[model samples]
Target: MDTGGGMNEHWQGVAEGLRDDTALLLAVQAEYRRLYERCFRDDPAVNHRLPVITHAFRRLGRWRVFLLLTPWMLARLLVPDEPPDIEIPADWRPAARRGAPYTMIGPAFSLELLTGRQKAHLNYSTAIGHYFLHPLVLAMAPFPTPEAVFGAWNDVIAARNANLEKMRRQNPQQEEISRREFFSGGFRK
Candidate 1:
């Protein structure tokens, strides 16, 4: 089925749901920020060589600074001089470029969108969700509302759940096939 309108409708539904669950959203967002900060700091050096380490450190340092400054910047805009709702841990630092640590920023952001309390701060979430649902919104010039923007998001979730069910149904059969192959010495090459 054509999911264009449905995708946008899903986005709206998710956004509305988040707005209704503001407290939970805030808590989740706060947790995400902390996780991101931790990843940035705990990243290991990609190479122990001094030159590579230096280069990676420089890049990571700049990224770390930007990440560190984000909360302060948001605080200034949202509540001047007030402490940020989320606290950056003492150990928080940027990940080295060489190590390229897998920061869970994407999932954290998704969680924020899933649980955000304020619609005004949803620009980031909307943008990210829009990208994910790009297929549905590609033909539309500008999505009418944030809800419409999330239509693709809902489609993705439905698709994922369906896939999981299909996998579960096929897994037993696949396991049996594997066992038969093993017993038959099918690996002889």
Candidate 2:
């Protein structure tokens, strides 16, 4: 799908990727396969396996940055800056909410489409999700609506917050120290 000058911007590096069989993409794809297997470890009674799905992001053109930041700014306005005052049982353990599945990965960002979650930020993210969800077919695709992705992502954030709470309890004194540091402009360079 060339768009005048060359390949469509959305599929820009893909031909090169396919031609060279990028080792990193291959490795990322393989690791996802393992995680996909783990997600269904309890389903030994079923002989069939789930299909892997792949997707690509639609091109954003000149409106990309505006599209990205508008929601972030709006969300910041809607959500207060102050932290919430809530309490949880000291012995409570984190549990997955019904039908909410997640995996923890180190944050990824890439300036170039060939690397990082920035690749997804700039392109159709179904390719990225395909590895995690293990869909059987991967076709040229577009990024889904932000609500579709981030709404579900709230679950992962909740899990992270629970773990952070546990850490705060374990090291209660550090909480005040960190708070003071933040309020006093002690950001690390």
Indicate the TM-score of model 1. 0.23
Q: How do all models score by TM-score?
A: 0.23, 0.24
Please list the C-alpha lDDT of all candidates, in the order they appear.
0.28, 0.30
**Model 2 Cα lDDT, one tens digit per residue, 60-134:** 221111111111111100110111122211221122111334433212223322122232111112222111111
Q: Which stretches of candidate 1 lie over 4 Å from their true place?
A: 1-142, 173-189
Backbone clashes for every candidate come to 13, 11
lDDT score for residue 2 of model 1: 11
Global CA lDDT computed for model 1: 0.28
Write candidate 1's Cα lDDT for 118-142 as tens digits. 2122112220121111012222223
CA lDDT, candidate 1, residue 179:
83
